[model samples]
Target chain A: MTPAEDYELPAGPGRNDNWQGVTPRQAFMRGMAVALTVPGIILFASAAGYGALARDAGFSLGNSVFMMGVFFALPAQVVLLDQIARGGSLMAGTLAVTLTGMRLLPMSVLLMPLLKGKRATRWRYLVAGHFIAVTAWMEGWRRLPLVPSELRMDHFIGIGTGLVLATLAGTWAGFELAGSVPHVVEAVLLLLTPIYFLLSLIASASGEADRLAIVLGGFLGPPLYVAFPGFDLLLAGIIGGSIARFVVRSRGTG
Target chain B: MTSSLHEVTQAAGAASGTLPTGLTLALILTVISLATHEPWRWLGLILGRNIDVDSELFRWVRAVSTALVAALVTRLVVFPAGALGGVPLLVRVLAMLCGLGVYLLFGRRISFGVVTAAVVLVAGQSIMGP
Candidate 1:
């Protein structure tokens, strides 16, 4: 997507809000800058867990890194590993991965408004939409509101692009070290991912609906897995979210 | 679940170790996964065109995504496989709770929660001595 023009912010102090002089190039760099911080380190660590798992699952180091690089979404990649482990057919694996990938749609939908300025094209959004990594999307939601419109797309691309290194590098490192490390150490690393995901969800959750969804989904997920197996994640999410929404709406109406 | 599928996997497994890098299953997997994942982004371009960002429908969809992630994260904690499966179930559950407890107690300081959880998780395994 081509940058048409810049939207300058009124002078401010809390953030570097002077957008008048910042080019899309500069904003893109800023996005990269933000992603390479503590959050980036956390992402790298989480991805390292993925690396260890992938190697243990019998994926080649090259393949694991390649998956991390291309998929960029951690959970979907894990689903692929799950499929392989089950000796699932390719069609089954594709369906499961696609269901997981559906989460990206809402993520992109929420981001669209933030990425818009005067006369922005669908191409820009299409580009911005691809960088829909969970952390990237969450970080974008948290950070992009402050950004002037034209630069949001570039900045998001930068954030997503920069995080790619940490993920790929982490995956590579994990795969290479999988067997060399003590079993205990590898186990601990693998354990970090679920804990990290849980904590991040708790930390980032906002308002009643998110809280409700988290609670309901937590209750629903394991039981659904027993009954539905591969359909657990999708069913849990949809059912939990719908119930939460319905309850919230009913409360509002009453 | 079927014999043909089993045969396919057996064949693929047999070939995986020795296959040339150019034609490895990994390369094919990357292509297939990428192909499946790509259409959703484009689908976003289409759906995002008319959607109002703050509408209830939008929020509900967002809720669905968050719930899905929650389900996924918890499933890993609950029904773990692979390396994590080695850790006892009690250890995993406690690790999650301890992390969550500290995270909530510390005004949502993520690093504090993670570090606390990591300590519990690793320690739980050592204490279990398996």
Candidate 2:
């Protein structure tokens, strides 16, 4: 097994034991380096796409770029923009976008333990949670175990900073280009966001359960859309996840 | 219809032709939405003994979050926006599937999956029109 595959550290050290080896600063810098490479490009492209979509939907360059800085979550931003375009009530749009962001809560909770030091305070978690996007989460999952516990936070900060800066710059660039670009270019640009997502999913899938979840999710998600239309995402996710859990459980028992 | 267009232009000019106020409001809402997750994180800290954010509980959360994000992306692709909005949904879905299939068949390389999917999409769109 590879180094990533061989190690499987629990979220927290047993008792209050601090991790050894790397310092937070070094790890953070390493993470930043990684972010600047493959992940940075992806984030830039995705954010640019968001800018283009926001422009196409008739949002201002300033507002679109501003949202990228503040919200940071793309899916919720997309939902919010789409709802507003449809003349949906501000309250309704807010609620929908917020609901879409509900997933972040758990994600933050899960990542906190990995990066938190034995003596770490609540405030640290609160701040770090802001950087908890899919890219960071996956990187943390893979790299946190390898680094000395003390340095995980630094690694995360390094990566998170790179990602945030890249996203911010990309969003602004896309917004500026929105008006001048043709519609087809915008469509393809927007399409790149999802394409990046699909590719990332392939990269992150580990173990039978994860594989099962993706396969089930992929097969079931599209069909559910055909049947339930707008509600397919929620329904298909619930069904796929439950099935994957059940299969994993059965296999364990057997 | 002509009069309505004129009215829209007037409104657009008055608003500095910027994004609609409702969208700005929505943007504000998105910013503050970060608070919603606070309560849950705190709750986990308080009651869930040994439940650090990195605990199994959070791992499940991360997994679910990953899936949800994936689902949203898939939704956008399957039910696109603006110009490609007119492209047949099946074609988009097929392109994604083809890309995914190629990725899986090639040992699940991220670059391959993304590039192949993107190529398939552009190629399919060009050949099929729209």
Candidate with best TM-score: 1
Give the alpha-carbon lDDT of every model.
0.71, 0.60
lDDT of 1 at A178: 67
Can you list each candidate's DockQ? 0.38, 0.24
Please report, as a residue range, the 10-residue window in candidate 1 chain B with the lowest summed lDDT: B1-10
Best prediction by lDDT? 1
Please give the distance, in angstroms, between residue B107's alpha carbon in candidate 1 and its true position after superposition: 2.1
**Global lDDT of model 2:** 0.60
| Alpha carbon lDDT at B52, candidate 1 | 56
lDDT of 2 by residue, B1-130 (tens): 1122123334544555343555655546555565543344344434433544434444344344445446656666755665556455665777788877876677655556666766776777777755
Across residues A82-133, which tens digit of lDDT does each residue of candidate 1 receive? 5575454556567657766765766676666687775356676655666776
Each model's fraction of native contacts: 0.52, 0.20
Q: By DockQ thresholds, what CAPRI class is model 2?
A: acceptable
lDDT of 2 by residue, A1-254 (tens): 01122122233444213345556565666677755665567778889888877776666777777777667777667766654554434464555454446555555545656776753466766555666666666656666776666677777777777788888889888877655677556556777777776666556544555556666766675566568644555555556656665676678731
- Isolated chain B TM-score per model: 0.65, 0.57
